[model samples]
Target: MSAKTKYTDEPIGPVKVIPDFLPPPEELVFKEDTVKVTIALSRESVEFFKREARKHDTQYQKMIRRLLDAYAVAHSKAKQNEITAKRPARRR
Candidate 1:
């Protein structure tokens, strides 16, 4: 007598199984204290961003975020000074 196989011999086209429909798997974790930002730019700038992103192996939006964050931190005082100096003098 021959032993029967437990698995099927037919080929499956594609698997549509979702492992974690209700929650993330053990290897995946969620961050709760993250901030989300949205920026709008021209198509040309977006292409430039994508190129830079590829060079750094990062997403374009992440590159923009890093740049904006650094600029805000480094130039906040200078920006404030410029805005204050631009205000017109009030007449007596």
Candidate 2:
């Protein structure tokens, strides 16, 4: 940053309208149903997630939960595709 930078107080041109590229407010409010359960994790795994979560400024538990959710979604899609491919085609 320079101390001698020039700045102007002139009025700007008319604002251009841009299309909104965001989901609706109602649609954005997603409430995830969660269950509390006790489980044991390895020391190394816990440490790894904790470090990464600290770097990202988020809770370690949330990071772990999102990771598991992504993995489940990937496997679920693969299983669905495999089943679809194995099914015989219908005749008209």
Q: Clash totals for all models, in order?
A: 0, 0
Residue lDDT tens for model 1, 2-90? 99868987897888975432323552364335487676689999999999999989899867765675567557867888999999998
Most lDDT-accurate candidate:
2
TM-score of 1: 0.44
TM-score of each model, in listed order: 0.44, 0.68
Task: Put down candidate 2 lDDT per residue, 1-92, tens digits, no spaces.
Answer: 76897789987889999754444579548977888878899999999999999999999998887778767867797899999999999899
RMSD of 1: 20.2
The count of backbone overlaps in candidate 1 is 0
Per-residue lDDT, model 1, residue 73, is 54
Indicate which candidate wins on TM-score: 2
Which pairs clash in the backbone of model 2? none
